[model samples]
Target: MKRALPLLIFMAISGAVFSQENPIGIFEDNKDIGNPKLAGSASYDETSQTYTIKGAGYNIWGQRDEHRYLYSKVKGDFVATANFEFEGNKEIHRKIGWMARASENDNSVMVGGFLHGDGLMAGQWRERKGADMQNPEDDVWAQKRYQQIIQLERRGNTFIVRAAHPGEPLQEISSKQLEFMPEAVLLGVVIGSHDENVIETARVWNARIDQPVAEDYNPGKDGWIGCRMETMNVFDGKRRVIHEKDGRFEAPNWMPDGKELLFNEDGSLYTIPINGGKTEKLNTGSADDLNNDHCISFDGKMLGISHNDGEGSNVFYLPLDGGEPKSVTQQAPSYLHGWAPNNKEVVYVAQRGENKVYDIYRKPIKGGKEVKLTDNKKWDHADGCEYSPDGKYIYYNGSKNGGTMQIWRMKPDGTEKEQITFDQYNNWFPHISPDGKWIAFISFSPDIELNSHPSYKKVMLRLMPTSGGAPKVIAHLYGGQGTINVNSWSPDSKHIAFVSNSKKSVKVD
Candidate 1:
């Protein structure tokens, strides 16, 4: 059933803007390639951060290609991802997916992940200008089309594409390396109609372009990238950028009052309205060398923090509004993670004894002997030890024998230990929702070290039922250590606030 593309007229779409220049979400330009018989158009919904591209082309196959591209020029290593679906399509050759090209010439050296109307997903590439397009002989034919997210990553001369359905982990589909490929390329969303006079439309959402730091790149030495303060609806998977800045900031803690969010930047704490506005720094007295490890008490009356006191990081507590922090741990390197539901005690990770292995420990707020919660092995590590809202269990991320990190839970008395998630990814920071019904956590690829949660990497924020079920990917972006170290769920449990990183200097009003 070869179907022709139809040009649908859309006017005054709610919250959407039809533009080719200025701000189009993350893209910088939108243009049509090859000048098809009929024109093409693109739109972006700022509220949903989604893109809709409509194009008419005479097949993007063979020697030359024609399509609509909404793109941004990216250099070096980068990862582009989006969830896309065509509208009113029947042509099996209609194409839509992520693409990278050396130039906008009608026939240019390019590589892209393409999803055809007939459920054929393949990595297509052109070796040189005016060359015939080529794809791997063995292509993935999804049983359910447009139900997965497409990710295209570039590592030097190599390009790779990976896809995953909802509630599942991403699996690599295809990859290729071209020696002639340039360092900079037009990385973006692409759509094409199989016929010249017809137009095809697609809606793409959750679109992200992440420029990761090098393996040896150090923020303090190489300079920091930009930051985006974003909130996402857990159920709908819709993200809204509430704030942006040109520096480093991490770990957003949703204020219990649900009006503002607290985060750490430049070793200090700052608060911003949930809807986006100016940031106000919190007065933490002299305890300024703070890290991302921080949490708000269940009662919302006090704030627990991990501050470096010239020796090492230690746990401290102060009034939620503003005040001098009081020391909670006598030992150095005690990082705060969670506050007891009773608001009388707090849990943190520390290295004691000669082995110096990190493990979970609990202590009273007023001051008392710290009780060791988990007796990890010499090589084992534990972090993000947070208590559920009902106080029934303490959820955290633990790694043993230098393996991948997995989510685990224990009783407040450090009993009834159980491992919740078992996968290849290094899952971290099990933050239970305020209602205690879901556990939201951040995940890193298996390639990363099991013991560390480094910043500036491709990561996912996942959600799963507290009782037990397959975790679903709630947000995919470039972030890591400072992304969601603390519980950032809105008080109503409908939204989550987190930070994402990018090398581009973007400021959303």
Candidate 2:
């Protein structure tokens, strides 16, 4: 969660209009401006200062006779505006401005303000019950000029739609209508042509929406609310340090008894009490070169770690009370990825050959031949493997489509594989909630390059339900390598324990 402190304060002073050029809460499409992913014959012409939308045919969603525009992921109170002129015949049945909150299936709660070719302006709210509630006629039909401005404002679940002629005050087109106000929505400007003729042009400029001023906007709070780099000290509510360090500390897996946190610090495994005290190094000795990936057995007696020992990294098991680690994999190059709910089998990434491509493999902790789970020609690069609380499925990250990684769940045998995340962001290190209803993982925005090496200064932790939905960012902190020490879930599932880093001085001795 990243905070917008200055913007919040600025929004307070100007009724949320912090800037004239780009208001705080509004997003606009000038056709000339913004990154456009336009569909159909809609194209922006900067030279003519217009956006030409040609209606060659009718689209099933009432778009063929209409020119459609789309903007996604809008939240909270906002205003949308557009300017346009019609050049073709008056056969166009509907010219309208629309605001919609679309669901995953594209079904939406649509607010439509339409102007007929005969010069009648009408507005209505489109619901599942069919387009019902229509507003009383104002001046929408009386004007001859094609130029217009349209605006939509939202508060809670209610939306207020308005429109006006050029140089005219915005008149209320519709009153507060109850609708499903999405946390994020899509805004669009549409023009309908009843005939095959083209709708001449729509030009949008100085269009913006601003968010209402919020009272709280601290940078630290912003880090928690937005994706901003900061530090979060993972402590037991009583201020007991589970895993503390100067750099990135991550993946704090709790012992079955919930007494200590199994975490990684500086690429090695360590344990700290729940009450916060000195960290005891888990002396893997030669297996000390470990990564952040580690977990404890269901019985809490054995600890499995992915570590490098002279030859290469592989899964190794040691006693929870600290002892010499015994290598579990016979293969030369394998890295531990996940532990089964039974704690008897461990899943890891196995490199094939000189090509360096990797896939997921599983083996028993009691020393058995490895079983290949995924075998894609391209690198599978499976990670964050964990069995569901009921031991029904194994959730992990897989790179099957090109090189982009996505969350995937498969049966323990590697069958029934399905992609979970569809967003453009990079989601990794999935930790399933103990109750099996949610998954928490690290999310890197499109701004963060995928191939870029992990650094402590940029990254965010996000949460999404295992049932499938948009991921919500939960923590904005500067640590990625070992952000979550292990599967340290609270008994109530209300909180999670993960390690993060800051520059503040501390005495490690």
Q: Pick the candidate with the highest TM-score.
A: 1
Give model 1 RMSD, 1 decimal: 7.7
Model 1 scores worst on lDDT over the 10 consecutive residues at 1-10
Q: For candidate 1, give the lDDT of residue 89.
A: 51
What value of lDDT does candidate 1 attain over all alpha carbons?
0.82
- Per-prediction count of colliding residue pairs? 0, 26
lDDT of 1 by residue, 432-454 (tens): 98998999999999898657888
lDDT of 2 by residue, 163-280 (tens): 6664334566666555554555545555444433443333343233334323343433443211111122222111122333323345677666656666765567767766666777
In model 1, pairs of residues that clash are none
Q: Which candidate wins on lDDT? A: 1
